[model samples]
Target chain A: MVFVVVLLTTMLLCICIGSVNIPLKNTLTAMWNTLWGLELPAGVSKNIILNVRLPRVINVALVGAALSLCGAAMQGLLRNPLADGSTLGVSSGASLGAVISLAFGVSIPGLEYAGTMIMAMLFAFLSLLLILSLAYVLDRSMSTNSIILIGVIFSMFTSSAMNLIITFADDHARSIAFWTMGSLSGTNYTQSAILLGTLLICGGIILRYARELNAFAVGEDNARHIGVNVKLVKLVILITVSVMIGVCVSISGTISFVGLVMPHMTRMIVGPNHKRLLASSMFSGAIFLLLADLVARTLLSPIELSIGVVTSLVGAVAFIIIFYRTRKAR
Target chain B: MLKAENVTVRYGDHTIVDHLSFHLQEGQWLMLAGPNGAGKSTLIHAVSQGAPYTGSITLADKDIRRYKPAHLAQKIGVLAQKNNVGYSYTVEEVVGLGRYAHSRGFLAGKDDDGEARVENALALTGLTELRKSNVLTLSGGELQRTFLAQVFAQDPEILILDEPANHLDLVYQKHIFSLIHEWLKIPGRAVLSVVHDLSLAKKYGTHAVLMNNGKCVSQGNINDVLTPQNLQAVYDMDVYSWMREMLGQWE
Candidate 1:
């Protein structure tokens, strides 16, 4: 309940603090007007708040929630504190897919604008399939360590492949690099709707298994002993998380640390019960990313920093603190 | 209530539990007694369906594999030797997980009956006072008791345990065994445990299977299977003299 309020407040604050600073009062009025289909009050720039910042903030919030939820689920499913979407090569695969589309001018007919996103989502799932297959072959049990190892190796391989592609495609190199660093500069309502839809569907699926995830905390065999079909649960969770991460990466590029840090931070407060942890992580992630995005754009007036840079810079420091505190607590 | 017919569990080319057979009758406490590598744990794992095995292990005459994971859980509960809890879950929360098979739907909220069972389990394991405590902060005995509480909450007809008290003080061992003994007194309930302590087995087990190198050397009545000669044959040591010598230290 508090999270909802804080999230809304943060969204409104973010919308008001961009390059063209809008007053909080006017921002509230604009939001109210938009909500009831009323015309914007005088002195309010409808274009800036409604069109420009609203969707951008919404996208940032959705991406943050999606990434954090996946991180929490992955950590529980794999029973590894270090597990996240990136730990399984999904982010790198999305990056590789996006880079391919950009460099080779690959655009879907009648949906040219969505080609990169489509390809990104496609390759993200493909990478998960590849990693799981390899892990299965290596260890029929598909142990968590083997899956993580394969994912790390697959990430490196795809990153190298992406680099090679970038080196040859000089014209699209800058755009590819920028996209990889992530940005919410030109996001519109359509992408926000898509991201919201994905977050809802995937987040719902992940939330449905909170109890199974709790059962997993005691170990896979223990979970199995308690009636969880460990193999099926793993497959379902990984696929659902992959789709969520794929869509987020396709829309916003690979925003690091949100997936890794938010859950850890939330766990400290919510105490590792997925029933609360997963949902709390979503709100915490949304808040953190909204603030990070705010700092990214406004930290340097007229020269926006990449949102990914701000997140990594902030997330890394926060993560170190969390690690040290947890170690000390232990 | 539970029976194993020539169950064989293999890892790659190495067979761990080779053609082992055992049956557990309701109201009986069956102990798997063996040395470290005698396949006792493997057999328990095979019975719990945690490991792949060739032969049929049945619960109530149904092949174990044929039951759905959740359905099987309703019939059998397992308490492993060491439970690795990586996260900080409260004792009550951990015990509540035992109700998973009974709960229905995607968002399986704890029903009133589940809450009652969890409370009963906590009380049964003497962890009711520590219900809110984080399991990670628990002592070895307490941790073992926490898992024992979980299995108790599961309310299965058959309980498979791998070293229920492996590294606890004498008091914890007694507490755990006594709890199991009390639980087994209920009708239609049985327990299969892998025990390293022959004295505990002798005291608590109604039936015993003595194994070495994945093959059962002796079986049937606990006292008959644990004869000094059988112990010496499997352990290659004068077991009765060593036990008497250890008892002299107490005197």
Candidate 2:
């Protein structure tokens, strides 16, 4: 409840403090007018507040929530604190698919504009499958070390492949490079809607298994003894998290560390129960990213930094502090 | 009741539990005793459906594998020797997980029956004061008791324990063993435990199986199976003399 209020306030603040600063009253009036099909207020510009800032902030929040939620689920599923989309190479797989679509103009039959997103999502699932199968073949127990090692190797492989594609496609190289660095500048209502839909569906699936995830805290075999179908739950959660990471990456590019750091931070506050941890992590992630995006755009007045750069900077520091504090506490 | 016939567990040609058979009747507390590599734990794993075995293991006349995981869980509860808890869950929350099979649906609210069971389990294990405490902050004995309380809350017909009190102090071992003994007093309940301490096994077990090199050397009543001659064959030592000498030291 506290997180929800803070998140709402953060969103309003982010909307009001962009390149063209609008007063809080005007922002609220604009939002109210937009909500009830009324005309825009006299002082508010629809293009700046409604069209540009609203969708951008909403996309940031949705992507933030999706990434953090997936991270929490992955960490619980693998029983490894460091597990996330990047660790498992799913984000890289999505990036590869997006790059392929952009470089070669690949398009689905009817959904031409959604080519990158569809391809990215497909490849994300494929990457998770490939990595899991490889890990399984190497070690039947699928030990945490083996899976993480395989994921890191696969991530490196995909990154190299993405570099090769960028090199060959000269015309789209600049755009592809910018996309990989992550941005919310290009997000519109359509992309925001898509992100919102994916977050809801995937988040719902992850939340449904909170008990099973709690069962996993005692180890996989014990979870089985406690009646959790370990294999089925693992499959369901990994697939769902992969879908979420794919969608978030396709829309906002690879925003590193939000998935890895937000969950750990939230776990400290809410304890390790997924019932509360997941929801709290979503709100915290949203607020963190909204603030990060705010800094990225406004930190250097006219020269905008990539949102990814800002997040990596802030997330790395936050992660180190969290790590140090937890270790010290222990 | 539980029964195993010609059960063999293998890991890539190396047989861990070879052609082992045992029966656990209601009201009986069976103890599986062996040396370090004698496959006692593996046999427990096979019975609990954690490991695959070649032969049949049945609960209440039905093949164990034929039952769904949830249904089987409602019948057999296993307390493993070592539980790897990575996160910090409250003691009560961990105990409440034992009631998972009894509940329905993903978003189901807390059941009144489950809450009462959890409360009863906490009190039984003397963890009522620590119900809200983080499990990670517990001592070894307290942690063991927490898991024992979980299995108690499960209310399964057959309780399988692997070294239920491995590294605890004598007081904790006695408390836990007596709790299991008292639990077996209820009709239609049975227990199978793996124990390294021959003395504890002789004291608490109604039936015993002595194993060496994945093969059972003797199986019968506790006194019959734990004979000095059989102990000598498996342990390669004068079993009675060593225990007598240790007892003399205590005196």
**How much of the true A–B contact set does each candidate keep?**
0.93, 0.81
What docking grade does candidate 2 earn? high
lDDT of 1 by residue, A50-73 (tens): 889999999999999999999999
Off by over 4 Å in 2: A108-113, A136-146, B106-110
Clashing pairs in 1: none
- lDDT of candidate 2 over B1-251, digit per residue (tens): 89999999999889999999999999999999978899999999888878878999988899998988888889999999997687998999999999988884745555668889999999988999999999889988888898999999998999999999876789888888999999999999999999999999999999999999999999989999999999999999999999999999978
CA lDDT for candidate 1:
0.90
DockQ of each: 0.88, 0.80
Model 1 Cα lDDT, one tens digit per residue, B1-251: 88898989889899888898988999989999988899999898888877789988888888888999988999999999988798999989889889889895646564668888999999878899999999889988888888888898989999888998876788878888998899899999999999888889999999999999999999999999999999999999999899999999999
Q: Write the per-residue lDDT of candidate 2 for residues A1-330, one digit (tens) a residue.
A: 899999999999999998889999998888898899999857687778888999999999999988898888888877778877688788999999999999999887876448888878888989989988998899776655777798899889999999999999999999889889899896889998888888888899899899888887657887889888777787788778888999898888889999999999999899999999889989999999999999999999899899999999999999999999989999
Candidate 2: give the TM-score of chain A. 0.94
Q: Where is the poorest 10-residue window by lDDT in model 1 chain A?
A: A105-114
